[model samples]
Target: MPANKLAVVTGASTGIGLELARCCAEDGFDLVIAANEPAIEAAAAELRKIGGSVVAVQADLATTEGVDKLYAAVGDRPIDALLANAGVGLGNAFLGQDFGRVRRVVDTNITGTLYLIHRVGNEMLRRNSGRILITGSVAGFTPGSFQAVYNGTKAFLDSFSFALREELRDSGVTVTCLMPGATETEFFRRADMMDTKVGTDKKDDPHEVAKAGFDAMLRGDSDIVTGVKNKLQTTVANVTPNEVLAKQHRKMAEPGTAKP
Candidate 1:
């Protein structure tokens, strides 16, 4: 509610992360934004024009060094919100995929995000105030064939957010998970999935998904699925057998599956 509460958004270089940073700035939050790309400087400058303090940290989020860079940017600021939205999407047939790339995905999406959450959440707990919004994906609920690594990383994030939310109940620190379905983002292009059905298809807007998470975090909801279609898919996946869900997912995510 303050005019200059501090908000830190990771993966703030592009896509959903960029939108989150913009939303926070509009809502009057001084921002500590981190991203791997050199372009984040432009994004930070744009936000600064909106009348909020802005600090941009450029670091590769797939390693400890990058996470440390992000923390160092925040320094001792008492953050009011933390948006752990940095992530990567990698799609490749399991057997033929590059193992190193798979590790990078896991490192960035799961390990790096969690490390930031741990540091920020502790500070939030100590201050007895803060909100955390994590970006998860609908892909987490099903077994993705070609996008296996990305999906698994999201599964960890979604599950971790739920558990963390419960643990932080009554602590004045809120944790919210934003599980978005297919969304138009640079993610697929970066992941080399531009030719896939899930990649090239019409998708939800990243701004919409960011707004959903922003609003939900303010409301202190534990988790939210952004789209109606994604809500239904989440419900069905919850009740369906894993095998059947995996088969369905494979149709959309596998590199060699035949479409009807």
Candidate 2:
């Protein structure tokens, strides 16, 4: 029998990453999933229950060494898909936040992410085939008040995804950006956004968001913002003044803005 297609998913321990992995598994792709936490092993086990091969790697995706470790785990297999979904978030005034935490967010969301994509994306280019799905956010379109750095990183990814797709247009490889809005994930708590109105508000389900992204990647779509509300938000952001947008964001993201 022929081997199944292989997919590598980062941040697969929870949320959208895990759901993306699930989508891959269900679609008959064997998976190599990585995360910065030991929960990855548990996630791997769950994926195995659905059948096909699953290798879980626990490594911090915030550093070169960690991305190297995850890359090493996929040594011989030609990757059919690469889901660059690992990222960190920070919620609070930029000046008041710890520099170390801020740096970690940037490193994970931008530096490390780019390093991994450059490595894996090049391989895909050589083969002239592969799918790359990057998890960006509609937040990229806004000036996030308390979540400035996180949104900034996503904006970079959103722009980068489209640019790379155009550069590789003739190649069989395709790059897609998955721009979801606030999701019901550990992101809010981890980012210290629990006190904000946006964090407390109802959020999109990660599974549905991932499904949209995974399907778009298979279809070679350039980008997808998963929810109707988010699509509207992005549309408005396009024409809104930056100053006004920033103020609106502050209302939703500022600390102590959560409703009773």
> Residue by residue across 17-134, what tens digits does model 2's lDDT show?
9999999999999999999999999999999999999999999999999999999999988999999999989999999999999999999999999999999999999999999999
Per-residue lDDT of 182 in model 1: 88
Q: Which ten residues in a row have the lowest lDDT in candidate 2?
A: 139-148
TM-score for predicted model 1 compared with the true structure: 0.95
List pairs with backbone clashes in candidate 2.
none
Count the clashes in each prediction. Answer: 0, 0
* Native-referenced Cα lDDT, model 2: 0.96
Task: Give per-model TM-scores.
Answer: 0.95, 0.99
Candidate 1 least-lDDT 10 residues = 251-260
Across 49-94, the per-residue lDDT of candidate 1 in tens digits comes to 8887999999998888899888988887798999999998888786
In order, the Cα lDDT scores of the candidates are: 0.88, 0.96
**Per-candidate RMSD vs. true structure?**
1.9, 0.5
Give lDDT: candidate 1, residue 158: 92
